[model samples]
Target: MTIAHSLGFPRIGKQRELKKAVEAYWRGKLNQEQLLAEGQKLRQQHWQWQAEAGLDYVPVGDFAWYDQVLNLSCTLGVIPERFLADAKQIPSEVGLELYFKMARGDTNEQGEVAACEMTKWFDTNYHYIVPEFTENQSFAISSSQLLEEIKEAAQQGLKPKPVLLGPLSYLWLGKAKGSDFNKLSLLDELIRVYGELLVKIADLGVEWIQLDEPILTLDLDNEWRQGFETAYNRLQSTPVNILLATYFGALGDNLGTAINLPTEGLHIDLVRAPEQLTSVVDRLPAYKVLSVGVVNGRNVWRTDLQQWLERLQPVKQRIGDRLWVGPSCSLLHSPVDLNQEQQFADDVRQWLAFAVQKNKEIAVLAKALAGDNSTEITAAIEASMAAFKEKNNSGRIHDETIQARVQAIDANMSIRQKPYNQRVVLQRQQLKLPLLPTTTIGSFPQTTAIRAARKAFKAGKLTEAEYRAEMKQQIADAVHRQETLDLDVLVHGEAERNDMVEYFGEQLSGFLFSQHGWVQSYGSRCVKPPIILGDIKREQPMTVEWIRYAQTLTNKPLKGMLTGPVTMLCWSFPREDVSREVSCLQLALALRDEVQDLEKAGIHIIQIDEPAIREGLPLRKAEWQQYLDWAVRCFKIASCGVENTTQIHTHMCYSEFNDIIEAIAALDADVITIETSRSDMELLDAFENFEYPNEIGPGVYDIHSPNIPSQDWIKQLLKKAANKIDLERLWVNPDCGLKTRDWSETEQALANMVAVAKELREEYQAS
Candidate 1:
């Protein structure tokens, strides 16, 4: 029988119980035992769900409390000196916190510790905290989370594929602290660590390991080319069969290198890079098992099984007995299951397939190829065909009117009503701001009461009027607090939004909201991205009521916040039928109308966040411009229609803006805010060197932590930023929004931020 396997499962629970439980543990509300129990429960439930969906090889060790890359760093004992020094007796909980801090800088009572820098994970918005290594990086294989998970799955009579980050991908993704990338000669030692890990798993009686070397999809040099063969050759004697899984893009030049390696099995992503199959089939070694990634992992569209079957035919002809079927990558990018979406209209639902549906597709494909001519499989494929045809014929897509408007948006249309030089004078004059303006990043804490009220309204427990009254009261109080604190700019505090992207997705056409589709963004933080179902169009104004109402209560310049088209399209599970550029353009057109409406409502300043813009760039440098061109064009289309006096701002979080400064500057916002607190204003160097001709707010504080930032800290950051950009054009704010923080921290942090700005202003005047 042809077997089906998964590279990994979504670690986030269906209801996001893992996020809540982890947060509870961090806050001392829940103990370690409780955290562990919750994790185990989630893993068991996930395994059972996949098994029920007919997945033959459910994966273990893919589940992580924080991140899989961080887990591998721990597994290899590559703990950086800083984390090791600060953590005297680090439990896994504290270890996890330190890990996240490395990925996204942290500020607590201990002061600021830079987050481990993050990098793109194969063109996905999902970020892995880059592992920091040193020449002295050692091996410590103490964590048995994988072993325990495998044992648990076996206890339930499920034999599982133990997933691990392959040695080459792990080392390639890491950097050595205070050392140049070229100087780190740790490959030999790193291979030893993996050799040790493989032997240990062999001792645990695991039969197969899904060792992910997704970097095999990228362009590589001789060093990485040499490392692959050297490491696997050393592990050839290990008892476990290593399945080297590569995904996210094509294996152009890397295919020959990969097939030449002495691994037992190879998994190729035919979904994204299907063109490479002609070469992949020709080059595979007779003994090497091939797992064809036929089903799409990153998209939500239902699979066309007939098309998939045709592709699988040639592969089956060559290696029919040895072939297996799987998803292009981990199903983590997709939602957990379509079974939970009870509210979707059947027609819309027919066109959709979540992670669970994708898994079943793989199983059915595997069985059909194995000569099981089940009537259900054929009928399901026919139904998918019918749905595809219906979607094509609906006239919902291909809007000539929208395309004409988009094509009409030329250089003049993209340019704001006023250029920066003029807009600067206009904005400073209109707002009557200081040299360095003080503001928050558009949201205050979303309190339990606010969440409860929103939930009550959604569940029909509270009337719309009651919900609105409470939300208005919350907004009024937030505005009053900012007023008392003497903040120059005001926001509605985003009390009405469950999430930045989801709130807009719920209102916009061509999108579908998931009731239980949740994924962990970071430590204990969850996001449910709206699913793009069809051509996107805005029926009416989405944020007008909230922004207009907030403006009524405040004389200050109220910044209307919207998620940019690129971010909305990037974050959501987009449809496979449409190109991302097309989807973004559709979202851009919808948001353009909203921008016009916000301006009409007399909102002078608007902040459209494109945090995921960098994530959407192509992995290869050569292909980056094409993506960035469309990305910037989409942003311009979304924001350029407003008047010159209307200041447009954009924000990016946890980004290293140096490499892409030119492209970012090309976006041409009047002012931009970015997360700089983590890097201690290291990101500002780009602006300084490039002489970026726009205003900026390098974040003065990190918002991810519970502890407040000191006035001294904010002062230091501002002083650093002032050296980089003109103090006249600089603004002071936190690295990002404060929605995740508690009331005490948010109030204290903002107060300190304002205090720093005031101190800087006094010094400028005195000088």
Candidate 2:
């Protein structure tokens, strides 16, 4: 019988129990023991759920209180300098405080910490804690989390296949505090620790361990090849059957190196990079069991069993007896079970499948290969094929009028209405701003009280009218506070929104909001991404009421905040039936109307953020331009309809900007704000090199932390920014929105920000 395995499961639980419990603990409502008990119960339930789904190899150690990478950091003693316990004598006690500190970070009673530096997890929206390395970095599997999980699963009569981030990926994704990218000296020590971890798991009688080496998908040179060899060699002594897994892209020449790595099993994602099947067949070791990732993992598309079988036939001929079929990667990205969606149109919902339904896809493909002709499986596969035909080439895809309009747009559409010179003259005169204007990235702190109110409103304790009144009050107060602070710009504080994407998704057509769909975007922070079910259109204005109302409250330039079309499309669970560009354009046309509405509302300085722009880039460099072209076009379409002096501003959260500077410029925003404090203004280097002409705000302080920055620190940042760009074009602000912070910090930070901006204005004028 073929074995079915999952690389991991969503840890947030079906109803987001973990998120509730963790937040409860942070609020002092739950104790450490209560938190641990909740975690254990969640893990047990997940294991049972996977087992009931008929998985042969259920996963363990994948559920984490914060992040699995942070857990590994704790186990390996790679704790950053600040999180390290000061006394050192009670090193064993450091586990609890250190882990939370690494995640939430230690701050005053106001909630601050030395914020953890977060980075992208292998091209997905999910973030992992970037491992901090020191010369004194030590390794020990201190926690019994993994072993306990395996033992618990065994008690439940399930054989668990534990998943681990392979040493190569772990080390490759890490950074030394102040070292060059070429630093490979830490690799040797990191691998030694990983080898010991393998030994520990083997000692616990764990037979199959899934070692995910996703770095195989990246552009690798000779150095990475040697690093892989050294790492796997040290880990080879363990009796555990290593299932070496690679996903997200094609293996190419890395296939030969992977096949020779002395692993007992090799897993390749035939669903993502299906061209790798030819290579997998050409280079299989005699004793190796091949786990073919045949089902779609990253997409919402259902598998065409007939097409999958065509790709599998050649591989099955060589290794049929030793073959296993599964999802191309973990089903964590896909929503929970499709059976839970009751509100969707029956026709559309019938054509969809979530994680639970996907398991059936894998199982049916396995049985079909084994020659089991069950009617249910056959009917399901047939329906999927029928749906694919209906949806892909459906009448819903193209609008002749929309297409004509898009085609009619010339290069001038991408250019602003009037040149920057004329627009700035009007904007400055209208706004009457001094040098070094101060503004925020368009959110105030989302406090516990506000969260409770929203949660209450969601549960129907508060009516729609009541909720709006409450949110309006919060917005009114936020605008009132900003005016009192004498800030140059103001925002509505966005207390009305639960999420940047979900807020707009609620008002848009063709999207479904889940009652219980929660996925971890990072440590302790979960997002409920809206699923696009069919053709999308705007039913009504999304942010107009909030923006117009907030504008009524303030005399200052109240910026109308909206999430751009490309971001709304990228951040949501997009429709797989059509090309992404088509879906993006659909959203762009809708937002274009909204932008015009906001301008009509008499709101100036409209900020449309595209934080996911970098996250949406294709994994391969050769294909990046195709994505960038459509992405920039979508953004331009959204912003172009507004008149000159409207002052469109775009904000991007933490990302590497050097590679896409030209594309960023193409967005043609009057101003752009980007996270720069964490990178030490290195992000601005791209603008300097590209000779970017637009005004810019390289964040003066890191918003990811609670560390209250002094006025001097902000001044220093402004001074450094002034050195690179013209001082007249600089704006001062934090790296991101202040939603995750407390009111005290938010108030103090802005007050300090304004002070620093004032000082800069005086100094620049004198110079």
Candidate 3:
């Protein structure tokens, strides 16, 4: 017999019930009890949905108020002493408030400590708070969220496999506090805490535990490699069966070390690197199970059932009943379900499967492998095959005219009109401005009024003319505000956009969207990425109307905002049948036309944001250059079509870019803005080492936090930035967009930012 299971489930809820409930609590609309009840309801809904799909084992501990890694950090009592000390006087029941404070800092009568720094989770777009460790750090089992969730799953009669981030990976993903110290030095104490947690799980009488150690797939040294051995070896005494899982890449040379662990099973991500299977099957131990992850959890494309069945048949024959089949990673990265995507057309809808449908596909595959070949199982396979065939030969998949243009592309389309040196000179002459030019990264806050108007328009409560008038007023207000603030460059405020990528996708051919298919970009931040199905083309002007209108209002020279091709493809779920390079090139071609149109509309400074380029890089160092080569090319193709004086700018956010400085230079935008405020000017070292020639805006304010920086603080950051960059090349801006921020804070923060820039200008003049 074969078993079907899930590594994890999406926590944002089907219709975004969790997001609404959480936001309501933050807004003081709901009490703590109300919010807890809502979270409980969402967890039950997700678990029952998976159980109904015939999964043998459903996962618990996947629900997070903010992030899963933060939950683990809090549960293990690895929180900083500052938060614990702050919570000493608070009531015991409100201890979870400390957890929330650690993830997103809160203020009271006492002094405030900022929230822990956040970074990209592995190579994915998901953000996790970095666990801070000190030399005297200690660990203990303090939180009961996991154990309580386990008991709750038992009440639902579902066999719960509580998922925990493996200790090795958790330690590897974190950083040391303030000073340089070996983070792995605290591994022993961390394993002790895990041992205690496992003992409790054993007491609950749970059968299997899923230990996610995704970092094992990365390059490891001798000490860190040996640390994995020591940690799991200590946990071998636990009664619960351990399923050590590795995903996002292959085990590669670590296969021997991984298989040799004294555990019940080892799960490998075959969806990413299928070639690792032969070696995994060969090294299988007789007494242990071998879980093969054949289904994709990150993408929305329907699994090729027949292809997966063929690959797993031989494995089932070898491993017999010990095999457990599931997604290659957690379903947390995917949308909730395909059935919720009612907005999709029939022709395109048949080719996609979200998180819920993927579970059913796994169940069907397990039955077929177990030789239970019922008519239902046979029909599922046949339908999947038909969907694949229809999607392959669809007339919408290609455009001969677009293909011809792409093929005829030469050196001219990929290169700017002038190199950085010549272009900067021409840009300065064309747009006379101050030394420290200030601008926002293309968007202002999307207020409740804007969201309500968009909702009304979608629901037919308002006419098209009414919607246009309202959004235009919002843009006019944005222009007026920028003039009041006296900023150098202005944006159209993007009030008409539901999202940057999705808005452009709505104007282009070959993309589909959902009313409620929201995925978490970070804490309380959700994005609905359009699904790219066929060949892409700009049917008409996407940004010209709003940008042209805003340009009329501001003599500050409006910066035409657009999401770059690489970011669009990286953010959206591209078709499974196409290579990313091909899909990206098609997107680039579509944007090339948009770029030319925006220029013709009298927009001088166009900002094409590519924050996802670093997120889309391959995990392995050996494969970075291959992916970056095309990614840079795609960005260039999208932004390089205009003249030198057009002044193209790009923005990157919330990433460690030390490794990709050359690729950053390769995009060759006339100006670039990066998120450096959170890291305290350390990110400038990359630009300093590269001696980056183009103008730069090292963001002076950390946009992610509501805690505004003082003018003195901002000036200090600028002083540090001056050491690395030339005075003429420096610009002033916030780290990213202010969409999530409210009007009051946005005004206060930008006011502080402008004052900081003026003070810096005074210093430059006196010198």
Look at candidate 1 and give me any clashing residue pairs. 101-115, 102-115, 102-116, 103-116, 105-115, 418-644
lDDT of 2 by residue, 1-767 (tens): 56777777778877778888987887789999999899999888888777777677788878888888887777676777665445543154335656777776566543333567776677677878878765555665667677778888888888889888888888777776755545467777777777777788888778899999987877788888888888788778877889999998888768778889988888888766877787787788889988888777765556777777666766677777678888888777776666777876655665666777777778777766766668976776688778777767656444566556555656655567887768888888777877888999998989777888899997999999998888888888899889877889889999989899998888877777775566778766788788776567778898898889988876778899999888898778877666788778778878888999999989878999998898888777878999999899889988988878799999997677589999998888889999887666878888787898889988988876657877777777788899898877888889899998888888898899998888778877997
Best by lDDT: 3
The number of clashing residue pairs in model 3 is 0
What lDDT tens digits, residue by residue, belong to model 3 across residues 1-767?
Answer: 78899899999998888888988887889999999999999999999999999899999988999889988887887777667664443232325677778777655555445677788988777899888888878887777889999999999898999999999999988878868889888998999889999999989989999999998899898888899899989999998999999999999888888999999999999999899999988998898888878889888888899998998898888889988889999988889888877777787788888899989998999889999789999999999999999988889788888778777777778898779998888889999988888889978999989999999998999999999999999999988988888888889899998888999898888787877677887877888888887778888888898889989887789999999998899889887766888888888988888889999999889999999889989988889999999999999999889988899999999888889998999899889999887677888999878878788999887777767667776888888998889989999999899888888888888888898888788889788
Q: Candidate 1 — what's its lDDT?
A: 0.82
lDDT of each: 0.82, 0.80, 0.87
Report the poorest 10 consecutive residues by lDDT, candidate 3.
86-95
lDDT of 3 at 84: 63
Q: Give each model's clash number.
A: 6, 0, 0
Q: Which portions of model 1 miss their true places by more than 4 Å?
A: 85-115, 118-120, 181-184, 395-404
How should the candidates be ordered by lDDT, best one leading? 3, 1, 2
Model 1 quality (TM-score) = 0.94
Measured on C-alpha atoms, candidate 2 has an lDDT of: 0.80
Better of 1 and 2 by lDDT: 1
